[model samples]
Target chain A: MQLALGPLLYCWPREQVLSFYEQAAGWPVEIVYLGEVVCSKRRVLSLDEWLDLAKHLESAGKQVVLSTLTLLEAGSELGALRRLCRNGHFDVEANDMAAVNILAAAGVEFIGGPTLNIYNPRTLAVLVGQGLRRWVLPFELSHPAASELINAAPASCTCEVFAWGRLPLSWSARCYTARAENRAKDQCEIICRNDPDGRLVSTREGQPFLTINGVQMQSALTQDLAPWIPEMEAAGIQVLRLSPQYSGMDEVVECFDRLRRDPGDQEVLRRLQSLAAVGVCDGYWHGEAGFANTANGLQQS
Target chain B: MQRMKLVCPAGNLPSLRAAVDGGADAVYLGFRDATNARHFAGLNFSRDSIQQGVQYAHGHGCKVFVAINTYPQPQGWTQWQRAVDEAADLGADALILADTGLLDYATRRWPDVARHLSVQASATNPEALSFYHRLFDIRRAVLPRVLSLRQVARLIEHSPVPVEVFGFGSLCVMAEGRCLLSSYVTGRSPNTYGACSPASHVRWEETDQGLESRLNEVLIDRYGPGEQAGYPTICKGRFRVGEHVYYAMEEPTSLNTLDILPELMRAGVAAIKVEGRQRSPAYVAQVTAVMRAAIDACLADPQAYKPHAAWQQALASVSEGTQTTLGAYHRPWL
Candidate 1:
């Protein structure tokens, strides 16, 4: 199985993003997904800048893929998607249907992003007919569902699973970060940069509930599937996608690399748990509530 | 001026009759299973009820659209396929679908049956709409409730087929078919089970401070004394972010596009959808009546169109939070 760095879902400073990629070039990850999949207003790195970074990562022996916006609202967003699809250098990860349509119309082979919602084999076959080369499984799919989908999927289409990072639970037109700051989406300042990883939203009882990253709502707990590598392999998943966090990503990459080399390493799992922003969860993989930490044998329904 | 079609929801036989009698040009419903987005207990239709609904609607010069919008799991495609075949056998006017596989199956197996893309497909742009229309030969596509008026107009100009927009009812702040927040808190979701924030997992507790609404043990909101409580959808819940506690996503409210009927007419929207199937027959009747009046008045005289105060009052009585906004149609809401 190959480790692929998923796109950065948070807003970061330009220098930090560049330096992170430069550092990531030396990591054990074979594939790197560059570009923003969250809010389109996050222009700290322009499309050209992302393409330039992709070139840098490619020279460092990393297979690069440009990820498209998850929600395309405006003509400008669709225009950006068209450019990404026609970039002609890196393969594009089609996150939304618009991206899929554009890529298919352009006769470009693309990787289906998790948000594309390919749940059944028939949807997979339709996408495969439209030149889909690889598909990242949606975060909510359980072990049995993923296994069934992989087994039924067209042989040419590869499967990737989100193995690490906070699960992106949902996306909305209303920007939660801007709303939290008491500003409308249009008139708001770029305040999401304040919380590089994303602002934590806690329940009234003060439990870590969710994270607000601009328009995207993510789980407070990072989904760690490292312990389930064998299960994923058994399910016929070829690529493990690790979403980039603001910190401790190198350690995360190394831990997954070490796990693939030595399957039953308790020390590596412990180190991975320590680096998670809000501990770890593997419940969705086990068909339980996504917030439940099934790895510790605690199954809360 | 073309009289815009008023599509309303019918959760049961009574609601189906009520919608047709209350001036609905058409009524959309789902079978009583995971095949539809409103898969609630004691709600939706059985095969007998759907056959009766089709006869009743057709008698009243109204059309019946069956919504089989949920994405089917790999092992469960047969259930959805059976639903499409049954709806077709029942002589329904159209099949409202979201899944590409279901659409493919429906179009191939029942070529003469009309197909409408459900809002759950989340096809916001003309390109996405074009793709669905080209592949499945869909007659109409329901626009997701996330587009601004101008964006809707632009899409209409480029669309390959006629479009439908949500005219009123409970608002989903997140894009439909894409949100997993419900499953994150509970085990059920709209995509997988056709229900979001399922009532089976909900608990209402009365505490010393207030009435708390919890979904799967996560406190969605706490209502103070005399505070009107809406349904505890996770998006409308209050949460603490940094030093402040507020409706971090959206406040409990409904979407009312009564005031924008003229603009929607100008945008060439073919149909206006009223969105509440998990409601009472009375709720369906009242909403369909007001929306019918509003649409007729707007189409009759676009220049002098004005939303009646009585119509607004009638809708507010049934609206959650006792208030309504234009939602994403208004630019500031975005």
Candidate 2:
């Protein structure tokens, strides 16, 4: 299976974003998803800058898709979606129906992003009628469920699973990051950039529960589904998506790339566990609580 | 301007009858199975009750809408299809659906039957509303509980289909259709199992900290003795962010738009929905009656509409946390 670099979900400096992709062009991944998928206030790089990055990635033999925001509330955000639809070159990953509507109207074959909520083959077929070429399995699907949907999917469509990073579990219009700092979404400064990975939220007993990264609520534990690489390959999975975190992402991608080739690399999974700042989990793949890791006989801690 | 329709919930036959008698223009309910959200035991309607509920509602000039809104899993696709077909055969007024495939089936099988997009569809913008309207010929769309009042007004003006906004009920801080926080903690979710924080996994224990509610051993909240406790919804739980411990996602509050009835009327909203299908018959009656009176008062004189003191008091008695906010509507952001 080929590895695809998912979008940079966090807000970083423009220079860091540019340089990350410049370095990412040399990574072992074949496909790269660019642009922000979480908040609209973050525009470190404009559409042209994203296109420029796309061109840069393409020149380095990477297929690029511009990912749109999962939630769109304002007309300005809609305008940006319209611009992404007419970007003229790179395909769009339609995060919401608003993006899908615009992309379908533009008559472009686009990838259905994880947030589209395609669970069954019929939903997949409905989108395929509107030119859906590839679809990302939503983060909540279990391994068996994912297999069922993937088996029934049209052969022309490439199925990609979110194989790494903190799983985004919830989203809201009121920014939890701003709220954590006692700030309003309209007047507060962009303090969400402070937590490069994401601000951790734990239960009152101090057990990790979730991560507040701007509007999106992610799992405090990073999900490492690399242990399922061989099974996914046998299940006809063509692509594995690795969401870019703030640190150790290159090595994470390399590990997934190398592990796909050599399934017996027991040390690779251990190294990946060391790389995750908040630990690892594959409970969603096991059809259990998403925060617990039971795969590969790992402890729940 | 025409008075907006007030839609309310009905968990069982008593609630269905209560909503009709309490002056609901429409009462939406779900099947007994997992095909709908609120799949709690002793809640929802059976096929026989659906028939009776529709007759009772139609007899009272109140519409009956059967909700088959949960995303149909691959294994249970036929169950959702059966729900739609049963709702159609039972002579319901509309089918509230969220899954695209179910909508496709309903569109093909019952083209003449009215289709209303469930809030679980999370169609916040006009483009999405148009997508449902064009694709499924949906008669109306329920807006997710995330848009500000101004955003709602602008969207209603441009939407191809009529718009419905929540009037009063439990608040969802996050988008309804996309959130997986419940399934993250419990194996069941609104999208898949039609239940958020399913009670089968909930456990309330007396601990040293206090009376604590846990979902599958995950701490939800701790309350002092005799203090009011909320349902174990993960979103409203107290959690620590950095140095502070509080309701990091949302407080245990209900969304009440009683203060903004006139503004909603001015916005030309087609309907006002109350957001509890798991509540009791008394709750359905009280909320439906208060909302009916409020809508009538607003329509009688938009310039001089006010939520009555008794109305607010009665609502607060049955509210989630004895607190209410014009959530997302008034932009209670700061």
Candidate 3:
């Protein structure tokens, strides 16, 4: 139905961060989730600057939502969450239950992020009671599982799916990006910016495995649902989230937008197959091993 | 004053008995299903075994907590719900749960049963911990092993429920309860399917460099000649950046908290957990007894408790890679 650009998980310089959103304003996307969702130590732009960018995105006819940190560690982190709740500029995507409480206490309506792990319909109803307007399905939910949950979704809530980009698998308090740079977590000088697409971690045999974006680790394979748009529609998916990567991001948005405009576009699907960085994987959607790819119609759905 | 509780893991009946005999105030375990987080072959309790184990623990003045922690699938919710009802009916001391929805269900369904929040919930701070109190009425919170002693103390000062911290065992580098790395590489997550670095995905190879440990055909870590190799979990593997390769996630080691008993006691941690459910009964007996003695000595004289060298020696005999550290307790950034 609609496309949502997920918040930038990787750290970028201030100019790069500003420039990226400036370009993103023109993309054919409905919702744009901004702010840092990975490590809180990465602060290339101040809170004020993020708000300014949110205002700019809103001006460009895109719905804006601010995202809080996935893992809250210290007092400073909680304080930032409070500020975001009280900012009153745009809605917030509550990544953790702590943020959910903060937003509920502040009397702010928010979108429930994927990390909240709302698996069942009753949980969705409860969150909706707490002023949750939208819910993003966690990456591990297969098509059959998501369809069951979506069928039971409350009429008041909208359901979104993580349809593209590397699946965010986990988050840690300890920064792996900092550790990889041979620096301590506290004193590490902004090392995550060194790799825009995240540091590609491979197996010993040179197979692409995972990408590390600060404390958050993601699958190396980009999840492409172009071939399953009909299935997603049947499952009542309202929005498809595309995560921000370093290169060919605009082309990614365009390819998906073209498919959205005209469903069953084989050329676009074939184009998506060739454009992904680490190739495409849809196995988790089929309830198989996450790395198992059944792209050639050889496996049963 | 009530002595702090020592909760230990028991994957099987033998370890359950060993834990109780070694002075564990309570032994926690899961049934043989996805409802439990440690669903390995030949491990965890069956429904019958849990009833027997609870009876055994209760007879010894010890408690048993059933861990029905993983999230319930759509069609699979009935199975997990049955575990909660059965664990409660079997007279378990408490139920350790992680999913918020499941916690809510258990609290409403079995109001009289004591409920503890599993570490997989990742409720690290006072604000997060308070959510369980306000909603599900969780009696205690098993904290993730990522907090520093000072942070833990601050949280204890604010928590309405009892706090439990890891005393010794395999320290998860990633945040507990939230990790999907294993599921991303394989298909099962500790939260969704009750497995991580699952045995089925593991493979060991004799490489030219040394021993290579892999998970799902992916090289997690490589050991040099004479260097001990640890099990391959993606987070604890060695990797390279700019031609400099090393242990990117963590050095091959386990957690040792015998030296930090004083700090944990001073911080008012209600329970100290030892985390190896897959370990041998001998390892459980030896580790639990050593910790029990250490806690007693610390209570008698906080400054006078000198951990015996033999305990550390015994610990090293069953360690993951023959090296251990006070993981995240002393060094929050390591």
Top candidate when judged by DockQ against the true structure: 1
Q: Model 1 off-target regions past 4 Å?
A: A297-301
Pick by DockQ: 1 or 2, better one: 1
lDDT of 1 by residue, A1-301 (tens): 9999999989888899989999999999999999989888988888888998999999999999999998878888888889888998799999987888888888999999998899898998889989899999988989999999888887888999999999999887889888888888897678898888999999888989999999999999999988899999988999999999999999999999999988678888888888998778888899888887878842221
Report the TM-score of chain B alone for all candidates.
0.99, 0.98, 0.96
lDDT of 3 by residue, A92-129 (tens): 99998888888777777889999888877767766776
Per-residue error at A104 for model 1, in Å?
1.5
How much is A278 displaced in model 3, in angstroms? 2.6
Please count the clashing residue pairs in each candidate, in the order shown: 0, 0, 1
Tell how far residue B318 is off in model 3, in angstroms.
1.7
Q: Positional deviation of B297 in candidate 2, in angstroms? A: 0.6
**Mind giving the per-residue lDDT tens digits that candidate 3 earns over B1-334?**
3567899989999999999999999999999978988888888988899988998999999999999989887888888889999999999889999887788788899999999999988887787887778888999999988887788888898888899999888878788877888887788889788989889889998977789888888788888887766778777787654455677677767888888888888888999999999888998998899889888988899888888898889887777787888877776555
Candidates in order, TM-scores: namely: 0.98, 0.98, 0.96
- Better candidate by DockQ, 1 or 3: 1
Return whichever of 2 and 3 wins on TM-score.
2
Residue A101 accuracy (lDDT) in model 1: 85
Model 2 over residues A5-124: C-alpha lDDT tens digits? 999988887788888898999999999999988989988888888898899899999999999988888878888889988898898999998888888888899999988889887898
